[model samples]
Target: MNGKTSVVKHRFDIKLARSMFGAISFGMALTTSAFAFDPLLTHGAIPMSPAAPLFANTGSGVCVFDSMPTPLTLNEAIERALCNNPKTREAWAQVKIRAAEVGIGRAAYLPTVSAQWRGVRDETTTNVTNYPQYSSNYRNSVLRTESVTLNWVLYDFGGRAAALQNANSLLEAAQASQEAALDDAFGAVSKDFYSAQGARGAVDAQKEIVAAAQQTFDAAKARADKGVAPISDQLQAQTTLAQAQLDETKAEGELATAIGTLNGDMGMEPNTALAMPPVDAGVKPDAMFQETVDALIETAKASYPSIRAAQSQLDAAQAKVRQTRAEGLPKLQFVAEYSHNNQPTTLAVGIPQFPATGHEWYLGLQVTIPIFEGFVRNYQIREAHAQADYQHEVLREAQIKVASDVWSAYQTLQTATASLVSNEALIEISRKSYEVSGHRYEKGVGNILELLSGLQAYARARVSWIRAVNEWRSARLQLAAKIGRIPSR
Candidate 1:
């Protein structure tokens, strides 16, 4: 009966030990699951930023182009550039980085919680030199400890607020800078698209000249065969035809180059082929340009992304100065900690070990006063002030530059608009002259030189007209961009 009782007691002790260990392990797991393993800590330990949606799937995979439009339009090209260009992606990344910084600054206002768990298998041996009877005693035990600590800054004399404000301002600056970058890309793609269309138009003009040259060559050859004209006339006509063909070939090459540039700007391979619709060169004058240049300048200064970015940078720098000043003041904090330890202890040799468990906890407020730190804080504050001053100048320079850009674009648009009328009239006059000279040569009344001269002049006039149309379109778009009216996204 006694043996059965001893066996029952041993089983009960084993069960009790297992329950204690399970309870401790379960408590530690709960602590970690509630704090350390929170979902917010999964994404690089940063809270989800408000800008997160804008940059979604950017890092998931690179953009793929399945099929291009049959005839890509200017708006489509701008959209592709904004979506796939490396420059836009880089700008988005900058915004994400700033957003993460803002999250970190906000985290400073929250309490920080940490948990620790430790277990050790310890073996000790003791020897008594004077008493051999008490020598060679050994003790074996297990030790377990668990702790959790929480610290929160209750007050910092505005240091945390300043830091958070600095972060917010920088985030604003990054967002504005991104807009500026996208607008620049939009303008670039628009110009390249128009330039490519112009090149195509040039090719068309060259084809017309080539046909006219061939007609002249055929007429001279027919007259020479009938002995009504000299062979030199036929030879000159043939030479003119060859020159016109060469010009056509050159124009085609220019068109190819322009298309390649447009492809590259759209974040595609340079050699990628793209079909583009012919640009409508009959753009009417916009009433927006009728406003005074000074008024436009004022509008741009008020809303231009570059100016806004500069202003935000200045605000961030000023906030940094305030943060630096606040860092030198005293801070108040709240701290709490809880700890537990369990181990086996033996008081003397030949005595069985006894299990001991202990727990400690404390909650209190802490005051941290900053004394002399080798004048580091003073220098930091000075540096911040200097930085603020520099940013102020940057804002001023941005305003000046925006004004200059508006003025230049406005003047360029006006010139391009005026040139369109002259170019159109020149084309008409040159075309009539070419036709008249061709008719006279066919009737054996005009020389080869007069016909060739008229042909060359007409071709030049056509090319000039194409250039004028492209310039007008480009100038208008640039002015709109300068006025901060271009939508990048």
Candidate 2:
């Protein structure tokens, strides 16, 4: 019984050990799997699937439209002018060139690397003599050699730094100049477009006047034929009609001239088919003189590119002076290079052969001290200082000019606004007077001469009204240009 008990105990111990070993193996397998998927695991766990891409897959396709070239709005015209005008495009190119110059200047702060190689061949003869013996001739041996080298300027007494600063300032100036050009172009185009509209409106008004005159003449002729009026009345009517026709012809010519001017401003062919926009007769000028003046001053301050350009030039000149002054100071730089050379040689009579392989490496520090350079540096510094002074004067001049322009435009706008009101009132009074005079003449209470006089006065008053309206329109556009907010289209 004791032996059976001992065997049972041994079997129980073996079963316990086997269970522990299986658990250990399972834990190791789990750890290994975790490590194997570490890249795809998050927060001590692995995802079962991949994440979706951020962008959606677009189907292959293209869109097309068939139509006549769309009519260009004012905004579109400005954009096209910027893109297509040769002068504007040239200015834009200049801006880019200056920007590249700035980059080049900035690059001076970084190290530069360069490489070079050279080869040479030579032959020579030599005579050798001992202390107490005759001289002996040695035949020349050919030598072939090659080498590579690298070099860097390292420092330039602060000249490079000053140059860089100047370049950056110039770039800024160029950008400002570009903006100024754009503003000028915008102003020019707007003025031309509005002027053309006014011209077309004037032509239409004149055509209507001509038609009215022709109808009056026809009625007068019919009355004379029926013996209801004198032949002189018909003659007077015909004379008025002829004058009206002449006026219409003049108006047509003026319209054509205005259109031509617009085409030139837009950089388009003079004969290009252009449709003039109808005038907005309902537009009223309501801003007070002081308010308009204040707005214009503000606009000039912020948007006048010429002023900004002058300021930029001033800044650049100052930078140049600073740079040149720096040139008179000391400079330091670090440099290093490695090279190898291989040469082949043949033995000559009684001459020993030399090894043909060579290698070399070097590291160095370079320093430059600016000494007297025949007063060249002095002259350069003086010139830069003068240029800086000149730029300041230019800036001052530009500011003054812009102020004058703004004030002039403001006054013109005010005058035009007032004139429009007066002209409109005069036109109304003249129309009433002419209508009364016509009724009196028709009833034979007023003479034909009085009727003709009233008609002429009425025509003159209408022409004045038209002229005033045009002036007002032009003045408003001028104000808009000064304020840099030409209405889009």
Candidate 3:
């Protein structure tokens, strides 16, 4: 019987150890998981701007880039800017922050569980002073306690719901603001790209003028050597060639400056080397520009990211008002706790110490009502209402400003388009007149002054034509931005 009893006790001990091990393992798993989860993991569930992930960082503070392209296109430039620029990243970070807030809001609907464990060594020293013959007594014991508690807010009179809605609205607003930042970056990079292209075109045009001047100088020198033209003609032609060379040099410098600006816009060092393909000859204004200004303004009002952000802000503020009002009401909560303790008892001076263990469980409903707090709740509600009203005006102002921007951009585009047409004609006419004057001077039928005048006119016309082209391109992009769209590459 003793042997059988020993076997049963050993088996029971093994079972008890296994149960404790399983419980500890489960608790450890839960703890590890709680720490391992990140708020960024919730981004997928939140509303995210499409532009937020363009050329996203691959790792912490690590943006990957292979090599710069030799002949980069406009789209490539835009991508590079988006990838490397900090403005869009800042906006994207705001989206993440707001997303975390949304997680906090959703978590309010769930219960919080906490576990606690404690151990203590207790010691006591006692002396019977009233009886002179009594001796001192010393005692020591070990105590342990373990507890698990759960608290859940069952009701808050709509405060939690309103707060969650506010968070969700702000998250949406953050996403829209991110999109607006991206649009700004896109517009800026495109403008720089076009400006660089125009500068390059000016340099090429200057080079062409220089070549023409050189040819004229050579002709006049040859005529002067043969005694057909006077030395004055050769002198004048040489001066013209020198002026053209100086202008070409200036144009080259301007081109360099433009390239540096474009590189900076792409988030590169200003002195970084950059190569870009020439603007396409087939490129033209977008067909969308054909719509009336009124129609365009209406479309912009409906879709502009700024307008969307404002609308969402208004929603968030309204929700805030609701939350503030609910703060004055009562809250209801459910509370529960389970606890166990192992303690030794020594009640009297001569009493022997005895081991004791106790288990306790509690369940209760908690109600909290806010009566008054120096009228703070009332003021908070008023502040929230004021903020909501302010947001409403902000939304209206955003719409009005977007419409005005569309109108201004539309007018600028119209003017640029008309100027482009006239400049095209002017360049052609000037080119023909310059050619005729050059031929006449070569044949000794026109004076050096006449030829120089025609050459200067042609140069001016070429410069004007280039400016007109760039203006038209820029105007189109501006209008597209106002309409909350990326300019077509």
Candidate 4:
């Protein structure tokens, strides 16, 4: 019985030794598998840090007061508009986009390089007829292929050249459009600036008139109270005072409206307080009419954005016609490629082998001739020609419009100048009449009605003079704009 027990223990020791060896082998296999798939060692993954900040100071912590007055000149206001106005910024961005398009078109003339990578894993099984039974064998295969190809356009029958030219012309057109927008914005700013200034002047003039009317009313009231003048005179004085108050209110409203418009144009909040810089209003109509017109036409021809934009459109359309016609011809290109390939195979059972590696290189010229496309190319060329014609018509129309605008501005300027001169003389005469009538009424030599009539005439003359000055200034600005001169900044 002791010997039987000893034999059983020996058998158990051998089985336990086998189990321990199997577990160690299994653990080693797992470690090998983990190493094979470790991305940190095999794939070399890179850890990336966060991006840095774009702005050093965001200005978010600054607080600005609403009542802080800034003395903004016309030039300063224009600069602000360019910097802050949404419309101008959008237009500027469009210019950049058009410029990039031109670059893209030009890139067509350059060669293109590209790479291709492909991997495949395939399995296969076969049946043998001699055994009359299916025999399955497991095989794992992987194929990785990479290639680099270069394609360059040798010639396109001038298609690429014409397209490049069209792109350049379109870029010019976009630039002109930007310039036109800038000019429009500047013109608007100038108009509003001058209008605001004129409104301010009108307010001052009306205040002066009000003061004069108040003085006359006080004198009439004093005389009526002393029993030297009739109660009707007192009533007339009160009416005059009421009219002056109404005039003052209207003038104040005009000033407020002008301020609002100017602030809005400057890209500021409507209620924001603005202080206007002083401008020199001593500009004289010194140049002769003929000289001015000649200079204006020359300036318009050189700098007018509309004319430049139209010319650019014409150029682009002409280029497009050439491009479309070239599409009917053959296109020539040069293509080249280089590649390396390796294939591994299993020759027999439990035997693995790798085949010889190979390298390939080739270059060739390819030509593509457009034989027929159901007359699509023909129609395209015809359409381009029509568009070219349309562009020409548009240019002609722009010329006519420019001429008409110049002529109208000239006429208006002449009329305004004459009116201003006449209004100045009338104001002088009315001021004399008012002074003489006021003195005579105080001495009881003239009637209150007569004095009031004189005052009314003087007020009318002053308002007319102010209106004339504003009209003349407006006409001059219009002439300056027509001539493509930048308004006074």
Candidate 5:
């Protein structure tokens, strides 16, 4: 059990040591480089990017189209937007970062290992007065030692456990946040798409008005030639035709703007031309809102991503309270080490080599209890308590907002539906009036002004019908998102 009696044999091969050292140095030198990686030059970690090799669906090469091609179906448009949208990707990144935090929290339980290699040379010179004490005028010696050390936190009064739980809760919160971002993206894309469709519908209606105006102009010219109408009547018809054409041009411009906005929402180039059919053709399924507002609000409180995210944050804050409380408690740790020492023979001293390899271990319970911390530990506990309370309030607010959003969206849908019915009636009445006015003018019984009035009223009714359909569709998307049903589509 004594030191000298427990000597162990060891070998020191200087040649082998030199070669190993040279190899390691050479390898590290070869691996070193001046060039740095550029993230901007390559494809990044987009959540569902089309460029992602794991993705299966195809997109239009991120707005590579020089001109408008075939219209995209609703499903295709939603898929593309989900893939390329920046907000979705950003939320996805947050999830990943929080997941890494979970790993960091778990790491607190593991031991920290460190190794060191040290070599030293000592030289000294003495005068003749001390020549009898030291026969040599100069003395030199070399020593090399290597050691491996470890430190492990044996216990921490539940601090590590609380931290791990906090990390897990944060990760869940991040995941819920990601889902919320996706829901938001879906709502935005749907609104933009339907708005574009509405604009296209308006353009088509304007074209019909222009065609009717052309017909009126031809009839006026015919009557004037037959001496049944004055030249002023023909001029009036021509002016109507000119104004109708201008209206059609303006509608086309507005349609272009809406299409650009939709493309931007999809994370594509704004200038990319994307065409779509009229709103009627792309009308989504109109399911009636049979559920009461209370049921819908309850569903939102339970299932909405925002609500789930807030709940997760509250859990994380509670864990943080535990972690902070433990900070003022006692902790325990363990320490151990292994070492090797070599003293090689020197040509000048004619001394024999003395090299030894040994193992050393230190095992004990270490305790650390905080005494005076400038009230920092107390402040941390209080702050965590405050944060927990704040998170609870935030969760309540999130639920309230979810219910409010659902109610608002429901009201909007109802209003849009009622407006659709009223618009339909208006369109029917305006169509009949236009027909009667056309007949009267052809028979020389009504003036050009009355015919023009009927035409304008019909055009307005048609535009309103198109917008009402889009508004209702957009409202449905909003409600579905509020209730966490966006991915159902």
Candidate 6:
């Protein structure tokens, strides 16, 4: 029983050791995979952009999409633009390039490995002289060697660190630029989408004007036929009809143009058909616009992406200065090498033959101090300082522009909101005048000239109403963008 127990215990120990060994092997594989390297500039390279969660390509491109929603909403138009716009894609690509720069900066902290090989063949002859005799010897020899060497930077007095920091700051600036691009895209899509609706509204108004003109022409013609009006009046009425028809044609063309423009903004083919359903006609004041101009300016200074991007750029430029300054400092590195040499044989006249093989290993530290280089390092540092100063000025200018934009957008919004009330009243009064004039003409008590004048004024008022609504909508979007709320539905 004791011998059986011993054998069983030994088997259990073997099983435990095998399990632990397997686990260790698995962990080693994972660690090796973690260190695997790939090229950065090739299609075969592993992607590094995913390391940055904030800046990823979000577009779905132009090929894969369902039909644009019928009577598409403004929010949907902005979304479509975000997914399809080439400008947005270009900005995202810029971020990827900056991300690659980060990898390049990091590589300065790693080792460089290189290999070398050499082969040689030699023919030699030697003469030996004695008191009364001379002898000669000749030999042929082959030599070969192979070696691999490594150089690793162990310290750089913060040069590598500064470069890495600069790369990261540039990447962050690119991300902020992307956000600004998205803001512009949203504002553009909203403005054009609403403008298309305004065009449609103008077309409908022209249609009504055409009908009214036709009625006036018919009245004039009937009076002429009954010998109650002169032929010149009928001629004038026919001219008015022709003019009205021309206006209708122009209005229809404008509608088509607006549609094409909207499609282009949505990153579709220019001729793609788009349905722009009108929003509700009344203009309402947005409470967000109630802030004072100074307040709005302050808000924009904090929220605008342009300002943020400029700030990031300034930071990158400062980091660049640090990197340049450190370039003049000393560098320290560790180096290791292995060399092997083989030569079969060497012989000469009156001498012995020799065979040789040599192997060597070396490890050492190398230091590089920048003593002088035609003042190049100094110039580099100066150039970096200049760039940093320029970035600072740029950041200052951006802040001023942000404030100006917010102020202008707020003024536009206030003007548009105030005009809405007056515009609505104009539409009501003009509409009433048109109805009265048309009714009197039907009863034969209205002058045709006065009736035509009223018709023109009424049509103008309707068109003006559409323009007013456009201004109001556009101003709201512009203000929203200035306040960092442009993507709102």
lDDT, candidate 3, 1-489, per-residue tens: 111111111111123466578789998998899766764355674323334343343333324456888777776788778766788778878888898898889899989999987655555444444442333343444467899999999999999999999999998998888878887888888788888888888888898999988988898899999999889988998999999999989988988998998888778888897876664442675576898899999999999999999999999999999999887899999999999998666675445667888999999999999887899988999999999999999999999999998999999999999998999999999999999998898778998888988988999999888888888888888888889866445
List where candidate 1 sits over 4 angstroms from the true fold: 1-66, 126-141, 279-285, 346-353, 487-489
Q: What is the number of backbone collisions in each predicted candidate, taken in the order shown? A: 0, 1, 0, 0, 0, 1
For candidate 1, write residues 159-242 as lDDT tens digits.
Answer: 999998998899888878877877777788889988998888888889988998898899889989999999998999999999
- The predicted structure with the larger TM-score, 3 or 6, is 3
TM, every model? 0.84, 0.75, 0.87, 0.77, 0.81, 0.78
Tens digit per residue, CA lDDT, model 6, 1-489: 111111111111123466568778987997887446444432222123321122234432322457778787776677677666787767768776787788888788889998776655544434333311223343434456889999998988899999988988888788778778777776787788778888888888888888888888988899889988777767877887888889889988998998898888777888988777764643455575777888778888887888988998999999999998888899999999999987545353334557778899999999999887899988988999999999999999999888888888888888988887688899899889988987886777877777777888888888888888888988898888777765245
Model 5 misplacement above 4 A? 1-69, 120-142, 343-359, 487-489
**Local distance difference test, candidate 2:** 0.65
Q: Tell me the TM-score of model 5.
A: 0.81
Q: Which stretches of candidate 2 lie above 4 Å from their native place?
A: 1-73, 76-79, 119-161, 281-283, 288-295, 345-355, 435-447, 483-489
Pairs of colliding residues, candidate 5: none
lDDT of each: 0.81, 0.65, 0.81, 0.70, 0.76, 0.75
Q: What 10-residue stretch in candidate 6 is worst by lDDT? A: 4-13
On TM-score, the stronger of 5 and 6 is 5
By lDDT, the better pick of 5 and 6 is: 5
The best candidate by TM-score is 3
lDDT of 2 by residue, 71-144 (tens): 33444444444444566666666665676666667667777665544333333333333321222232223322
Model 1, residue 447: distance off in Å is: 3.1
Winner of 1 and 3 under TM-score: 3
Ranking 4 against 6 by lDDT, winner: 6
Regions of candidate 3 where Cα sits further than 4 Å from its true position: 1-41, 45-66, 126-128, 131-141, 280-282, 349-352
